[model samples]
Target: MSSYLDGGGGCRKRRRGGERIFKFKSFGENGCPVEFDGSFRNNVKALVEYGNLEMNLCNDGVLCWTFQLEVHRHPPLNVLLFVVEEPVRASSINLHCKHCRYVGWGNHMICNKKYHFLLPSKDTVASCFNCDETNSYESNPEKGKLNLVELKGHIMHGVFHSNGFGHLLCVNGMEMGSDQLAGYQITEFWDRLCTGLQARKVSLCDTSRKRGMELRLLYGVAYGHPWFGRWGYKFGRGCYGVNKPIYQKAIEAIQGIPLCLLNHHLSISNNEVSVIFSRYQALSDHSIVTLGDLLHFMLKLRSRLPEENITSSCNPTTVETNCRWSPKRVEAATRVIVEALKNREFRWVSRQEVRDAARAYIGDTGLLDFVLKSLGNHIVGNYLVRRCLNPVTKVLEYCLEDISTVFPNSEALIMNNSKAKPRNKITKVQLMKDIGYLYKHILNDQKPTMSTGVLSAIPMATRIILDTKFLLKEYTEEQLPIRGNSFKLFCTVTLRNNEGIDEGSKKPMLPYECVSFNENTTFDELRQEVEKCFREVYWRLRSFVVEAVANMSVKGSDLVVGSVEMGQKLVFIGSNDDQIGSEDSSGTGIVDCLCGAKEDDGERLISCDICEVWQHTSHALANADADALLNNIEKWVVIMMNLQRFYLGILHIFTCPVVRNNVKVL
Candidate 1:
């Protein structure tokens, strides 16, 4: 509230309404008296009348006003004004809640009423303050409640620069009790004030302007009122004028305190310590701390130590040395690398690419390299030169060996030819399997013969070689048809990693094997053939449990196919097992289920007692019957146990109509 211009000559004048006006003789850069023009003067007079504002002239001949109006017999509200170059000392101001009328001053204020603010528009130089009342302890009705009431007055001040821009500073409402003003009322006041200032050619700075004015707040004032952010005020401009050095010193003092000590003193959780430390680390020598952030720091220290000792405790004399690649920095760098890799299109990435991606977060190169090397599976080559062969070039070279197309040895020709060639539809796994099949026939000293399916699945160049050698033949010409319908079944066998065998020493297995079968092939015959093939490929299936599952290519999921007569892709997953299954004389391992639906169809299956046929509970039982079975499951289980026909493996049980006319009731 201090005047920018001081010791200016004053000339007294009178208007027609007998209202005295003191004109300041302060000169502008143009040598003209820095006085309000007649139009601005009249505008101020009209605003004062409309708002019922009481006008007053300061000793410096500057105009000011106090808002005091009663529209409907309301009590006269007093407007409190305080002028200070720095923050108002806590000792000088009294803090109180309007509800309890408690007049005690403290570092923290507790109120039962929660206030909500409506932010101002970005273009408006003024701000509107309002609040909605929320009961803090609504669950406990017996507790005393605070009510929302109209605030006494708004606390604001204006400062104008000689560069034709102005800044309007407003104090937070918590201390002055002026936060509950209506939106329209605050808007009207700001509009009139801004208009008068604009008439005097004092343009308020707006963010939309290319070269807007800077609004600087006092370090102490802004730090004391964190709630000003709710009114759209940002506090990143440091402090006003000479107070910046003091603000920087305070920031450094706070930063000097160990995060662990702060967490312990504040009773903050370990999980929250990282967050608080991150925010603390963000504070630099040139920044100010909001009151909300430093509230606990100030209260705890002030309560335990004297004012002079507080600074000493915050800034301890001892300093602890830390490693450059600390655990926290390593973790941060790892997170950045992981996030970058997730966004990347390819699995393989170079060290330089990773370094560039994480440069923003991890400025230190040595720390990033350490973290990269620590990633056991992610790192490809040497610690310094972590690079992978370019996948695009590898794909192009692989295609060149398969296709008949020829191109120059230059990089440009390879790239262009790769695009020009027909897109290869076969996967690398399929191509490898075809080559293995051909090699096996040759090793046996037999003529290498391939069906149309195998020939079509190989690369174009390999297909041309087979055609020229007269090794590929039509499906009908290669062999006569079997008794019934015939189809080829594609099978994949995945062997469990043996304990004693090294991965590199193990033989390379084909991706999948194809076997021809007819409708005459029984389930037992198909199972035997698969087991024989597994033994020939790896070893005997004695040490492994082979579970065959059909991969429904259309559905993109593996399902247990009932028959191998139809063509389908099968996956044989083998796991090492120490104990082989003993033959069950009662046939417990056998699945003689009548239900055609797959187990993964999400329906509950129940087994019958007599035939031991698995049937879907939904299809076999009525809703009420199923509910009754569920309600009395224990009794039914006891009945089944007594009959020696209980199957604990099955979750639900009910007799199928085909086995029995009526379901036996327990």
Candidate 2:
């Protein structure tokens, strides 16, 4: 007989040399031994010493034992009972296999007395007996090979030693009816094993006292299984394993596991899961939930409950409002803006284009502005009101300065191969040509009327004058021209006969002349010079009227010849003696309206009493109901002036519909 210590440090004896085996119904007619095999005997002894196993002596002197058994067919049979005819042994009994030199006593090649004489069948054997084949049981004809679905149902099993080191036994799926395996059975089994291990210390300790000890590290062998990696298990030296000191892999596993399955297994409510997930999200700065600190938090939660759910659906509003700005996302957005500008031909980009580049990461306009403002040193404008002239329109518009300019300024130089060259001084002849081209278009009615569009076109003609540097002229009291300071004005002169008939039968004689003048020339002096050119003409000259075109309309204002802008058009109307004194020489009676209508047309006129400017009544009023308002024009002007709607130009008059219907109007 061999003696060993039981769980309470009491000595126990094991019976030996029993050739006459006593059979019990539980062990079958071919009685099985109650001794453990060499490989697994130490694990059984540890469990017994920790009080995980219960032993009692029966009235008949038979020893009965109760414990949990985790097997391949049914996991965690929590109340397996066995009767021992003698004292339970603590030491392992080793047996040898001649074929493979394997020295395990139970289930390796054959079941021996160590396994209570249980027969070595396909379901119970670990290796083949005669051939020493390790995979013989898996290849057995009676046990069909597992399909992909059945293979996915594998479960995990492990034991944590007192030294804080854990050993994984196996993760294998059992053969079962199709109905028994459904809906993430593998994860379910893993949760159960983890739960059992977490409670192992508590369940083994005496109930009268409480212990706070827990497993620290869990290491497992995956046996070349690829799915082990999918569960956050890493590999080392051709074996897969997991280490949970900080539970980094545990958090990874929780992230991959479905929330619904976790909730089901962990018995966590949806609201509780949401709270935990929200807390994690609030603490994480970036859009993604992969921070190390957050992962540590989730691992701590999982450690507390073992099966605690760590992932759940988050509230979108809460996530948007509470999440801190991420430096990585800001960096990404900045990179996008820079790249967009770098790909462009100009050093400036519109605000809309900048917004579009970073829209994916920074959706809020104000937040995007804040980001742009933070890059103020790199960009050109204040966040809200940066302005740049549009290349196409030449109009000032909101824009962002290209970050490429601030970073190196080399990218802009490389991209803009056709950068604008400095404008040279425009010659007098070139300025004349540009003005003439504009006049030609205006005379042909091909250009739009003088509105904002025509005003925009003025820059095209004036750009030549703006680019030129003219030398100032020194004028004498006699007004003799300074040679270098003089420019030629090209004009077309039309001469009419005394009776207002053309000199030619087909058309009036339009003579072209080039008049030269200096900066000191007055309007009267220039007129006299032009009169000298036609001194010998048969028709007597009338008053010489010089009119300047202003605001796209010919105005009768007195012309100061030397003060004329470079591109301004001038008209000289010379009538015969019969036409003299018939019309005002200054042409003061002329009127121009905002609608481009002039005075003395057939349409009735309505004039603003205050400014005395005339507008055609048809152009000013949509209906005749405004006749009363027109009669009281002074009162209407006062009301419009008080409302700040009175403009000095053409009058746009209208009586409200309420007044037309005879309703009292405010």
Which one is best on lDDT?
A: 1
- In order, the Cα lDDT scores of the candidates are 0.29, 0.29
Q: Estimate each model's TM-score.
A: 0.18, 0.18
Model 1, runs deviating above 4 Å: 1-43, 49-195, 198-244, 251-271, 275-666
Model 1 weakest 10-residue run by lDDT: 396-405
Candidate 2 lDDT tens digits, 61-138: 222232222222233111122212222121122222221111111111111112110111222211112111233334
RMSD, each candidate, Å? 43.2, 50.1
Worst 10 residues of 2 by lDDT: 201-210
Model 1 residue 288 distance off true place after TM-score fit, in angstroms = 16
lDDT of 1 by residue, 350-455 (tens): 5566678889877888877766555422211111111222322221000001111111121111111235223212233332333233223211112223222212
